[model samples]
Target: MIVQTLPGRRAFIRENTRLQAPPHTPELSLHLADEVTPIWRLTEEALEEIGLPPPFWAFAWAGGQALARYVLDHPDIVAGRRVVDFATGSGIVAIAAMKAGARRVLATDIDVFCEAAVGLNAEANAVAVDFTDQNLLNAPPPQADVLLAGDICYERPMAEAVMAWLRRGREAGARVLIGDPGRTYFPKDGLEKLAEYQVPTTRELEDLAVKRTSVWTLP
Candidate 1:
């Protein structure tokens, strides 16, 4: 519907969300929608009616929070490396990679709104994170020393496609890392668990106040 003008999107983000630190990664702040925010009450159908994308960029999902925490705690994983953050909702992982000393980070998402969301978030954290609305799965994975993805295994088809693409990136020499909260579609094999956490979340978003999430690497 062409409703996502950059200025409007930025204003929407600022007006509907607040800059807050994620529970698991308190060192970084992001513009996130909380229970008190108007956006928090919006359903997918309502958002679609208003020509807005699902508000994935408006919250710090458990997977992204855990992955960001892991990256910040173990900076060596991304330090001095070129990184790509796939499905970078709110750009939490990308910002973490930059804070962890990555040489550069390209945050990619199909949702056009994320460009605005990530820009605001990077500014909040005082970090530089490049963002694109490109669907990275369509091309050869960009050259990267580290590739990060989080909370992307919700739907079956998307999970399969993303995992396949991540595997290709791993085969091409990029170290691929994923953070998940045991979604039904998340693969049950062929990954190395690096860390696990009882990530604090909101029941309104995840139907639970705490989620057991984990960070995994594609070896």
Candidate 2:
């Protein structure tokens, strides 16, 4: 299905599909399609075996890399806590939060396709995540103990809004952490960097072999 909606002045166009988990890995290969290029495939079993779920929006460059690295490093952040995986694309961060022992996980995305993608990927990983497809601007603020966001700062206005929300979360006593790959808009002053990694990115975006990404906490 294709959806078109106007959130104020910005145009939002999304194509989405609802799918079930595959009985075997072969039936569940994640695809990455570049501009004017054929889809590249990576299987679910490959990701699961490596302790990851399908990289939902891998084509976005920084998001996927930050998510993968976050899971590998700070699974404890979500352990025994209520979590909100903001802008959850492939449900990777949500799944990782669940695996890390989050009591409950809410995966959010404004994109309609994310509704199904997150559900399928969560089921495939045997993780339970409540999916919210509502626009963040209109939705209630999440009441989770921990808030996780990855690669949401590429765009200026979105980044600014997200930063404001995160600041509010911090003020409300929720632990707010973000995984960002040095995007131009990431707030630099109040955040304490936790971990850094070299991430996979595309040629169209940047020229680094691995982009430098970090997990930062708002102080």
Task: List, residue by residue over 1-219, the lDDT tens digit for candidate 2.
Answer: 012222211111112222332111222322223431211122222222343333344344465446545654666777889988888876667777787678998888875446655665666667778988777655446788988888888779989998888888888889887888888888778789877767665564566756787878887
Overall local distance difference test of candidate 2: 0.63
The TM-scores of all predictions, comma-separated, are 0.93, 0.72
Note the Cα lDDT for every prediction shown: 0.89, 0.63
What would the TM-score be for candidate 2 when compared with the true structure?
0.72
Candidate 1's TM-score reads 0.93
Best by TM-score: 1
Error of 2 at 110 (Å): 0.6
Per-residue alpha-carbon lDDT of candidate 1 for residues 25-64, written as tens digits (9 for 90 to 100): 9999999887633674453333456655457998999999
Residue 39 C-alpha lDDT in model 1: 77
Candidate topping lDDT: 1
> Which run of 10 residues does model 1 get worst, by summed lDDT?
40-49
Question: Which residue pairs in model 2 clash with each other?
Answer: none
